[model samples]
Each structure stands twice: as C-alpha cells, then as structure tokens.
Target: MKEKKSMIEEEKEDHLKSTKRIEMEEQLANPDEEPQEVISEKEEY
Candidate 1:
C-alpha cells in the first residue's frame, strides 16, 4: 500500500512538471502573446 501511494504521488508531481514545461515552451514560441495573457490574468484577480 505504501509503495502504491508513493508511485501515485510521483506521477502527480511528474504530470505537474510536464505541464509547466509545456506552458513554458508555448510562451517561448509566442513571446508577444504571453505578456497579454499574463496581463489579462492578473486583471482578473
């Protein structure tokens, strides 16, 4: 049971890291778009 739980946690962390990496790649691909997106997101808050 402990081993299974640890495996699940590891998978979650890996998934989050991968998602962040993808976002970074997209931002890099379109440097101009990212700033506008960020500004709008901040305005929402």
Candidate 2:
C-alpha cells in the first residue's frame, strides 16, 4: 500500500513550478516589460 501511495504522490504535479520557470525565461527575454501580477498588486494599494 505504501509503495502504491508513493507512486501516486510521485505522479502528482506542481503546476507552479512550470509557470515560474516560464516566467523567468520571459523576464530574461524582456527585462523592460513588467509582469501583470506586479501591476495588479500595485493597483491594490
């Protein structure tokens, strides 16, 4: 049972990991452009 559980856990995915890597690449490609997340956060203030 533990072996099966471990296999299932290993299969689980972390979507944010891929998103962050893509974000970093985009930043490197266009350092001048601001990310929308930062803009939205600033608007919250």
TM-score of each model, in listed order:
0.69, 0.48
lDDT of 1 at 26: 69
| lDDT of candidate 1 over 1-45, digit per residue (tens) | 999999999999999999788768768887877756865776899
Query: Per-residue lDDT of 1-45 in model 2, one digit per residue for the tens?
Result: 999988777666455567677778777776886667644665899
Runs in model 1 lying further than 4 Å from the true structure: 35-45
Query: What are the lDDT figures for the candidates, one per model?
Result: 0.82, 0.70
Error of 2 at 9 (Å): 8.2
In candidate 1, clashing pairs total 0
